[model samples]
Target: MTETKEWFESWFDSPYHGMLYQRRDEHEASAFIDKLFAWLQPAAASSVLDIACGDGRHAAYMKNYVHEVIGIDLSEQRIQKAQKLAKENLAFYKQDMRNVFRLNYFDYAFNFFTSFGYFQHYRDNVIAADSFAKSLKPGGRLMIDYMNVDRVKDQLVAEEVVEVEGICFNIHRKSENGKIIKTIQFKDASGKPYSFEEVVSEFRLPDFKELFERCGLQLITTFGDYELNPFNVEVSPRLIMIFEKH
Candidate 1:
């Protein structure tokens, strides 16, 4: 069948996407969350929001720290799977990040693992940021973990092929017109071929600062990585930012 839908909507729902990223480190993710909790030290019964909570891995672990957790993702398949882990302290919903989510209801919000910046337009990104900000109460914080665009551009791999569980994925990456684009091509076990593209805006700190300020969020701090080291534009593997609602 010919494909016409937006890339993320189709790609993220594919079972192959999960398989390709199966090596994502759970221990590392948990450690990062633990460090965040140690630093933020939210109240024992604080309400937490996990934006783009794929498969609810981080959100599930969050139950150990926060009073309650709401995990939302654009992918219905992922949400359906994540729903199985929901308890009194945790819940999952399929939601678009651009829409308001229970305004002023959360004490802390998280957008982790470079999950953002998939939209084609800059305005959509701003809208998503605004939605996240509106979801938080005054004095609430939102933590965003994204790739260091400078570092990624400096070390961009033009092309590669990776095989996972007998499925071969041909990957191509490039920077064009202030955006980083990735194209993935692969075939299923039955020999059916498919292709998908991922587009991320080249959003730097200044871009984010502008968006946050417009949304009434004050930039609190920036970290280089999950361990919360100081951000270095030239060397940081990750750009971790914290913003507070004033």
Candidate 2:
């Protein structure tokens, strides 16, 4: 059987994807969320929306701070697992980022862990921005954690092989047409082969400002890493941005 869906539609749903990036677990998520909450000092009554909340790890931890938290992701498998973590004020849904889950509902919206820039179409990216802004209240805020385009381009490993749980994944990377492309090839225990491709747009700060501004989201602050350090174009591994809804 040949896989024909869009790369994200197929790749993100794969059990292997979860295995490959398993280290992005609750501990890592909680660390970053703690740093973020310390800086933001959000109100105890604030409501949160976690966009692309894979497995609801971040959203589950977030409920400890905010009044309530809703998490949404496009992957059904991920969302199913995330749903098990739901509680009175925590909920998970299989949802797309390009569509509004709630209008003017949340005090804060979080897009974390380099989740943006997945759509190959620039228009689709803009649509996602619109949804992000619309999900927040007028005085609400948005936090986006992404990879620093400059650093990723400079430090990209052209090729590598990683074995996790005895499954060997051969990875290749390249930059093309304003996007970073990663190709992952691997085989299962049964000797079945699989391949997956990941494409993320090379979105710089200026690019985000343009796309978000059009959706009434104003950039407020920018950080370079999980520690909330000032962004350095040449050095930062992560591009963490905060925006306010207008």
Candidate 3:
């Protein structure tokens, strides 16, 4: 837990941070969010909660469909950006999602784009899951979008480098103990570099199913991708799981 916290906080102070909702990946993110909302079918009056909601892109998108939206992230800078773009009934908070939070307030909750599984200790993941469960109203639904470990393993790219917005980044990945550990190095235009390694621990399908059950939720659906395709060993690029509080 300490390692994960330090790694994330280091990036929180940098401008080249919060890859999830930052503008660089907006198109891909919006496509995924469209599919998520279509499947969830949230009502206009439903209150939605987004855990680890980076820059609150999904929460902003949800404003068109829901009565209220709340996004929470650990990075204060990202939350401030979210708040600046907030509209009526949309808000953002900066807080650790693994602690006891204001309870039973949301009609639906979502954690998208492999946002879960950063904890160094297994108990930390459990604590975060419990916090998510407690944040929802009875019978509320939760959606978690994560990389399909099974599929990612099949297509593991040992190392790759790419340039986005004139910033060079390198990605290295390996699979161990049914988990993927990735190291990302970001270099500014001037060639100054900073690297962070993240271990996404024990996040295969069966592991997540067990966690959901232990948190008092029933698995409702598991899809291979954001498009809601049936999961198959050779076909899926992502894992999208839906759960309902029992």
Report the candidate with higher TM-score, 2 versus 3.
2
TM-score, candidate 2, is 0.97
Which has the higher lDDT value, candidate number 1 or candidate number 3?
A: 1
Model 3 residue 185 CA deviation in Å? 3.1
- State the TM-score for model 3: 0.89
C-alpha lDDT values of all predictions: 0.93, 0.93, 0.81
* 1-246 per-residue lDDT for model 2 (tens digits): 994566899998999998998865566667889999999999999999999998888899999998999999999999999999998989999999999999999999999988999886789899999999999999899999999999999999999999999999999999999999999999899999999999999999999999999999999999998889999999999999999998
Instruction: List the candidate 1 regions with Cα displacement exceeding 4 Å.
Output: 1-4
Misplaced by over 4 Å in model 3 are 1-4, 18-25, 186-191
Q: Taking the tens digit of each residue's C-alpha lDDT, what string does model 3 give over 179-199?
A: 688788886667777787767
lDDT of 1 by residue, 62-131 (tens): 9898889999999999999999999997999999999988999999999999889888778888899999
> Between which residue pairs do clashes occur in model 3?
none
77 in model 3: Cα distance from truth in Å?
Answer: 1.4
| Best-first order by TM-score | 1, 2, 3
Estimate TM-scores for all models: 0.97, 0.97, 0.89
